[model samples]
Target: MGQVLFYKDLWKEEFWENPWELGGLIVIGLFTVTFLFFILFAVLFGLLFPSEQTENEE
Candidate 1:
């Protein structure tokens, strides 16, 4: 690993070594999970409450 960073090293960097680019995948995964949970809870609540009438409306 240290040889790659040396001035005389012939090899470049591996793909995973980039610092900034990796965070995008984590952020995207997090958002996707949140979105899926939002949809799931929306469905669950809609089924549980039926949305026909608010009981508190009376």
Candidate 2:
């Protein structure tokens, strides 16, 4: 238990030492994943099937 607490405290100190760097990396990763998700879906839908054209009556 003592070892665990010591490790936890160390981790907290390290995390607080440079929060901005970690936060920025997390935010960038999230955005990259999100952008890739939308792009993949858009491409999949775009290539899946063609849209049908309706005939106009005069």
Candidate 3:
């Protein structure tokens, strides 16, 4: 029996030629996920805690 790999994985030599692209992709993906997490947290935090208003009496 034989196994098959994706086209991207099949091109091992070509893939290593510019490995930085893969690293960049990983970094970009990490940042994207982090950005999404921060956005979600920001929305949740804002909904959970609204700003308090200060009242001044003369």
Q: Highest TM-score: which candidate?
A: 1
TM-score of each: 0.58, 0.56, 0.56
Query: TM-score: which is higher, 1 or 2?
Result: 1
- The TM-score that candidate 3 achieves is 0.56
lDDT of each: 0.75, 0.89, 0.82
Judge candidate 2 at residue 17 and give its lDDT.
79
Each model's Cα RMSD: 8.2, 6.8, 5.5
**Between 2 and 3, whose lDDT is larger?**
2
lDDT of 3 by residue, 1-58 (tens): 1344665566776766777978988899999999999999999999999987768633
lDDT at position 24, candidate 2: 88
Assess the local accuracy of residue 53 in candidate 1 as a C-alpha lDDT between 0 and 100: 64
Candidate 3, position 57, lDDT: 31
Using lDDT as the measure, which candidate wins?
A: 2
Ranking of predictions according to lDDT:
2, 3, 1
Q: Per model, how many backbone clashes are there?
A: 0, 0, 0
Model 2 regions more than 4 Å off: 1-17, 56-58
- Minimum summed lDDT over a 10-residue window in model 2 is located at 49-58
Candidate 2 lDDT over 31-53, as tens digits, reads 99999999999999988975666
Residue 25, candidate 3: C-alpha displacement in angstroms: 0.9
